[model samples]
Target: DAGITQSPRHKVTETGTPVTLRCHQTENHRYMYWYRQDPGHGLRLIHYSYGVKDTDKGEVSDGYSVSRSKTEDFLLTLESATSSQTSVYFCAIRQGIGQPQHFGDGTRLSIL
Candidate 1:
């Protein structure tokens, strides 16, 4: 499991609402990432953090934002929920870019 944890294993919300997901890692890695899983497109990165308070946007970052205030904790927030954004969100952590990333169980979000 690589000591990674994700909260609210599942969630359901109405469109236009705000949602936040949390990821925690006990590995103390420098790199943390958030990704969304859809049926056909596989997994796509949403945001990532390289270190404490150091984060960057990923390919699909338009409606999503992320924060990492400490090495073990990373957060993902959806500013406005939408049906298009409803998917299984995953959190991963790695010691470095070249290293393998270990993923958390994931949080399944549904927008109604």
Candidate 2:
């Protein structure tokens, strides 16, 4: 197993609604991340955690938030979603930062 899954591979939301996406990993990895992929930006990091409760925001963290309290699960929440937030969200993990990351398929999020 690749040790990961994202919930609701497809979604449609209004311009300003609260939405949450789930990322599940089976293998115990040391790092997990949330990233959004768009036509122009390619992939941009939203947030990540090195361990339980040891997370920090990333470059595109505005209006978005994340939490990881367990080794196998990471959650991303859009507090007040907007149309501009429509994009494919991917979850990733790495045994260590120096190495490449393994990514989940992706959660297709559409904020109206």
Candidate 3:
């Protein structure tokens, strides 16, 4: 198993507020990613990290930010929450290039 854990299984916040979601892994994976799942777009990557303090933006990275300061932890932050940003967020970890990724249960976020 990947041994991944996502915090705050559910969240509801007002628009314009800042929110953060965290992902923790017990396995020492080298790569970690944050993705948001929506009805029409499927799964879209928000940000990813190759190593500690080495992070890059993904396809839908405009309103989101990510940080990875340790091997086991990846954090996703919304600069200012919006209704359009309301979706299920998932965190995945992979050992390397061709390895399978393991995902957490995901956090359900609702913005009103």
Candidate 4:
């Protein structure tokens, strides 16, 4: 949605390091999501939150963690950066199931 924003649109980190990315929304949507996109593989969900403090792992949950302490914010953390984790990460929000989800501009992460 127009109210959703992802911070530090770009980042570079070394392998084995920890990195955290933030997503902030003003729309007050109950559903928020984190996804990663890589060439050829398309988009993959990393994690999602149904509401404040309620989050679940997705298809690529390994090495990644997420937290949502308030309705307007969600955080994605990479426990240990890896070269394979380098990709464009995106944050999305929707009012409810079946509703169109709007996405924020992706964060491009590079692990050296």
Record all residue pairs in model 2 with backbone atoms less than 3 Å apart, i.e. clashing: none
Residues 1-112 of candidate 3 have per-residue lDDT tens digits of 5799999899999999999999999999999999999999899999999999999999999989888889999999998999999999999999999998889999999999
lDDT string for model 2 (1-112, tens) is: 4789999899999987999999999878889999999997899999999999889999899999898989999999999999989999999998876988999999999876
Q: What TM-score does prediction 3 earn? A: 0.97
Inter-residue clash pairs, candidate 3:
none
**Alpha-carbon shift of residue 73 in model 1 (angstroms):** 0.8
**Per-residue lDDT for 6-93 in model 4, tens only?**
9899999999999999999999899999999999988899999999999999999999999999999999999889999999999999
The C-alpha stretches of model 3 lying farther than 4 A from their native spots are none
Candidate 3, lDDT over the whole model = 0.95
State which candidate, 1 or 2, has the greater lDDT.
Answer: 1
Local error of candidate 2 at residue 106 (angstroms): 0.2
Measured against the true structure, the TM-scores of the candidates, in listed sequence, are: 0.96, 0.95, 0.97, 0.97
Considering lDDT, which of the candidate structures 1 and 3 is the better prediction for this target?
3
Worst 10 residues of 2 by lDDT: 92-101
- Report the number of clashing residue pairs per model: 0, 0, 0, 0
* Shift in Å, residue 2, candidate 3: 1.4
Off by over 4 Å in 2: none
